[model samples]
Target: MQDGTVERMPRQDDAIRNLTMVVYILQIVNLFGVPGAIVGVIINYVKRDEARDTLWDSHFSWQIRTFWWALLGAAISYPLIILFGLGFLTGALVWCWYVYRIVRGFLAFNDGKPLPR
Candidate 1:
């Protein structure tokens, strides 16, 4: 009414968004080997504080949890492979779970939404 200027909403930090994407990409590459996941989680730990109180923080938390839980699942599943080949089933389940987490998190990140805590 008074002025013809439009107000703009604040934008998220590009660096944080880029870092989050890198981790998600790394996690996806994890399907091939452990190194990618390892690097991704390390980045999460190091940059977690920077993301605090922002939407990206939830993503960092999600990724960290995904890594640890998947690791634990593998730890248990691999032993069963030696015991009676049950690990084949358990390992598949863990792999599916891992993929689901990465995909879900990536979708949320792209949508500019935070994961439910």
Candidate 2:
């Protein structure tokens, strides 16, 4: 080595955090669609074991729940729309809830805090 010093790269957990945050932001911008959410959830699953006992555990749990719940919301609303045309309101509310979760989780992550119980 030139100076007997080594550069340290970012840790695995840090990479997971950063990548997850990027996925959230992309979703917020509507540039991601379902594909991005799936990618984020996959990362969450892969790193979940590593995140045990850490604040990231909550974040991962919250994120995965968000995805499933949001999907359920959409599915429920679709039938309502087809059968009664009242699904618009339900869909809108679900969209808002999804956005709220993303923003809340993103902020908590940046502040190094766990999601609320």
Candidate 3:
């Protein structure tokens, strides 16, 4: 109000938005890898019920889907790599796709845009 801003965000929304970024950052860091990502997903799921009425719910959904699909890709492709030496390419492509999704979601969150379903 002192700055004469027309609108202000609630503290809860701010926290949700910040946490969304943390999840994405943890995944991209790759040292935590999927396990770190799993932690993020668990947080998302636990907070998701509270998030249901807020804009940040979209982020939770986006992150959860991203984690599962990436896991599926790794599970399927790694075996191919181990057995036939052919899954490496697929695995790399999947990883790239996951990165893209994470970046896209982050950008949307930053821009205050709703993620596409």
* Top TM-score prediction, candidate number: 1
Clashing pairs in 3: none
Estimate the TM-score for candidate 1. 0.88
lDDT by residue (1-117, candidate 2, tens digit) is 589999888887787677667666655654235457777677778877877776677888888898889889989999999899999999889989998999898889888898965
The candidate with the higher lDDT, 1 or 2, is 1
All candidates in order of lDDT, best leading: 1, 3, 2
lDDT by residue for model 1 over 13-65, one digit each (tens)? 67788899999999999998757989999999998888898889999999999
Cα lDDT of candidate 3 equals: 0.84
Model-by-model lDDT, in order?
0.93, 0.79, 0.84
Q: Order of all candidates by TM-score, from best down to worst? A: 1, 3, 2
Best candidate, lDDT: 1
Please provide, for model 3 over 1-117, each residue's C-alpha lDDT reduced to its tens digit, 9 standing for 90 to 100.
678877865788788877888887877775345468888888898888877777788888998999999999999999999899889998998888998998999888888877766
Query: How far out, in Å, is residue 56 in model 1?
Result: 0.2
Each candidate's number of clashing pairs is 0, 0, 0
Q: Show the lowest summed lDDT stretch of 10 residues, model 1.
A: 6-15
